[model samples]
Target chain A: MKTLNENAQSVGTILLEIGALLMSSGASTNRTRITMERIARGLGYGIELLITQRALMLTIIEKDQQHFFSRLKRISPHGANFRIVSGISHLSWNVMEQDWTIAQISEEVQRLKALPHYPRLVVLGMVGLAGAGFCRIFGGGYIEMTVAFVATVAGLFVRQEATKAKFNPYLCIFFAAFAASLIAGTAEYLKIGTEPDKALATSVLFLVPGIPLINSVTDLMDGNIQNGMVRAMNGLMIAFSIAMGLLSVKMILNF
Target chain B: MIFLEIITKSFWAGIAAMGFAVLFNVPRRAILSIGMLGAVGGLIKFTVMNFDIGIIFASFLGATAIGIISIQMAHMRNSPPLVFSIPSVIPMVPGMFAYKMMLGLIALTSIENTDDYLQSLISTVNNGAKAMFILISLGTGVAIPMLLSRKESIKKSKFNKKKEVTV
Candidate 1:
């Protein structure tokens, strides 16, 4: 059996890892805090956690002894994987509700952290379908829908490649939008679609910061004003990058 | 014809939402429900717009519908509300307005005559404001239901209650 301090150190490390995963995965501050608290509570200790866009501070008090763990984790916002999030969530809930040992919980966390995301080709296909769907909803003709689908697939492929190359997210989005808009513009120039404008617009819909914007507002509403502002600004910057990318293609085409 | 348009739009919106669900890597089991939520939200927005309501108001109602449904889905599925809500809301994002705003800005810069510049500037501002307002409304609409549900959860959790008392 580990000593109390040893157990505390291990728990703190696991909690910090979980918190970093949550933050990097685009979870709001409240979700991160609540989940960490739940895990600490499950370990028969109470914790005070402070989370920001840059770092996490956790203080756990057990048996009248105070243990402080501070982790410096830069939040590099990335794709959302609800599977890992909900998996960790369920694990924490189970820990709180069941009689699970510390080792078991840690093992589960590791397993969840290692869960693989969907393949790149699958994601690309879905995003292309989504673009086509948006085009149709926005009143694009069948031809325009087809063009949008092809454009979005090409764009998302570029995005995936850029991401795998570890390019900055803004640059990735910019290139992706550039590629998509270029294809859509070519389609328009060829008169392949009656609603080329609609196709062009919808083909880049995948870049919209829908989840981040909502998360920002939810954070603000929940009273994490500073983090909310940071997230909102980040989302706005991404939107600007996407616009810049699309505009570059339009300028080149003089359309 | 109008009703048919709404149906088609909603159907497409559902497909879009499902695609987003897959993009976000939401759990396979929750994809269908998220798609249904997006469809309901899109239907509400389309129907309300047919009544001549402004797009902002239409987006608000649609997002609210999504928010409420997401909360219910979260409870039923034992998952976080964000899992369902985020993808469902993607179908209603104002991507076109943002694009138009950028176009206006580009036009504003390229124009030589003052009159043309001012015209482009006005259009730019209009599109930007509309986009911002729509985004704000979407945020507020989703936040309301989420905030309410969060409060209820806090009240129900005894650990949180004790923590509150201590703090």
Candidate 2:
């Protein structure tokens, strides 16, 4: 079993490296769904099962449990390599704490890899958009609109599995713009109302400053001098990206 | 022509709102709901003005409704109240006012419209200030509901304590 021992050791090292890559990928601002799935695959689990597990993990309160899934969530294209490595380290610690043998851990990874995955996330997005359109038709006012929009956004946010798609910034921006255009185009086509300006403004409201605002405000309030400033800067970058997406479209449309 | 303008304008507005929400890392669901709500609110308010209600009152009421909606969202999501409220109300924000002020500043610095400059500058600043006040009032209005809810919670907690002592 010296051979078995060596094989287990090799698997552990490889898994750890993969985990590191995942952590870096996880740092992306949005859509970490793909990276997490890959990480689950690397650990030897099916993609779909991993996503469900990750979702449940998010609903957990313990730092360790939540941290594992958060790292998976970071699979968005914007994630840095270091972040994935950090996440792998976090998971490794969990393994170590559990007193599992290297072979056992490797076996666990292998087991996870064999599960089947379904692409419900994308379907959810399409369905949600369609539902919003329907709501608009029924003369649904602000409340219905808000519910539909929020539900659509929440559905996308939850999918996080899409984050692992080939990491291309230009493509990401395009998708962002495309989503906005669809929302705007649908509402406009339906003649949701005569006030197109207001409707357009409302449709895009989903992209406003949120986490950064909260993080920056909290850090600043708590007197975490350096941390607060850094968070604020990060928040600004996110806003900049959003502006880039909108402005690009606006220029194309001559707005 | 007005119909075309409405569509184009709403499209841009949607892009702006969606972009901002994504940037902020607000949950996608919350963003979608707020975006749609804000758009509807903007449309409804604009339409209602034909009935002769003052613009300020209309704006305040619309914004307040959004605030209340967001608060309900926060409760449903188990997130902080502002998480949903802040982003939800953004579509109705006076971005044009801010844009105009900047444009006026640029014009003053770039050329000599000597006769018209002071008056325009003053007007630009006045408009910007007014917009800022509107935002402040909206923010205050949003906070009042949250604050009142907190006060209610405090009273409930105190009442529970008294009951505990008596028991």
Q: Give the DockQ-based CAPRI class for model 2.
A: incorrect
Off by over 4 Å in 1: A1-6, A63-67, B149-167
List, residue by residue over B1-167, the lDDT tens digit for candidate 1.
Answer: 98999999998899899888988888877888988998999999999999999999999999988877776677666677778877988888887787678778767767999988888888889888888788878888876664554563432533232332211
Highest-TM-score candidate: 1
Per-residue lDDT over A232-252 for candidate 1, one digit per residue giving the tens place of the 0 to 100 score: 888878788888988888889
Best by DockQ: 1
Inter-residue clash pairs, candidate 1: none
**What level of docking quality does candidate 1 show?**
acceptable
- DockQ per candidate: 0.47, 0.06
Q: Compose the digit string of candidate 2's lDDT tens values, residues B1-167.
A: 65544444344344444444443344444556656655655555454544687555555666666666665554454333444555445555544344345445555675667668888889779756755455544544444553455542211332132321210
In model 2, where do residues sit more than 4 Å from their true spots?
A: A1-255, B1-23, B28-36, B47-57, B150-167
